[model samples]
Target: MEYNPQSKQEPLDTESEDRFASEQPSEFQQPYQYQEMKQDFKHSGPGIASFVISMVTVLGYVIAFVVVGAMATSVFDQSGNLLASASEVIITIGISVLILSALNVIGVVVGIVGLALRNRRKVFGIIGTIINGVIVLLFMMLISTVFVNAGGL
Candidate 1:
């Protein structure tokens, strides 16, 4: 009953210690649960790679269009005569398109693999796959139009 400021406090009772221990779960007791949580929180590298490739492909396409448009605009003369032949420009554009198409194919494949893994970053994979698919479809349509115009349809 005496108020002694310097006195050591009594140790916790056995019942109180047991209750406190029971309230907080030990990390080692449920390591498997934590392992699953860690796996769930892991970042998906393939998904991010696919998204970056898709974005780069889109940017390449835009640059190609700009370059080709500039060439087409400048290659013609004031009287619509050929200031410079367009065959070389056309060939260069064709080669660039082929390279971009190959990149889009790779992006789509990587995106599919990422989606199959079912990671938290699957959205990036899904978007990349969609963009690649659209580009492929557009390329196919362009090829079909060329065939039709050439009387090979």
Candidate 2:
């Protein structure tokens, strides 16, 4: 292709683009539909739901961590023998883990549904499913360790 000197060219607005992001929040800013990356596609609702549920599971995990931290000193005596309060830790961990696992299961189910949706973006669904699956696997490993320690190997 030959460059035609006579053809008119649109000037690039380099100054506007070079401005810092914080200095560019104006009502005149282009809406999403007008942006170059905007597409004729919608994100799946189920995918969003799954992602949200995955985030919620993190809260339960945090609670479990807090319980473990608060009770760490009592879980075992200085002699390394399991103490009476160890049972409390086990029960709390067990109950919280089960609840979190249930949430992960729900997230996975919703993510699957999102992936099956027509003409919808699958990024969130894939991400949520992978995160939830990994968490479930980690929980399984923890439970297996408990069994092993109990002489169930």
Tell me each candidate's TM-score: 0.69, 0.64
**Mind giving the per-residue lDDT tens digits that candidate 2 earns over 1-153?**
243243257654677447545465677785456543425668899998988888889877997889788887777878899988788888888788898999999998999999999888888899888888888888889889988899954
**Winning model by lDDT:** 2
Candidate 2 regions exceeding 4 Å error are 1-38, 144-153
Cα deviation in Å at residue 72, candidate 2?
2.0
RMSD (Cα, Å) of model 1: 10.7
Off by over 4 Å in 1: 1-40, 81-84, 118-120
| lDDT value, residue 91 of candidate 2 | 89
Per-residue lDDT tens digits of candidate 1, residues 1-153?
Answer: 243343366766799679768866698675334335434655467777788988999999999989998889877878987665878778879999999999988988988887787536577778888998789789889999998899954
Model 2: colliding residue pairs: none
Task: Provide the global lDDT of candidate 1 against the true structure.
Answer: 0.81
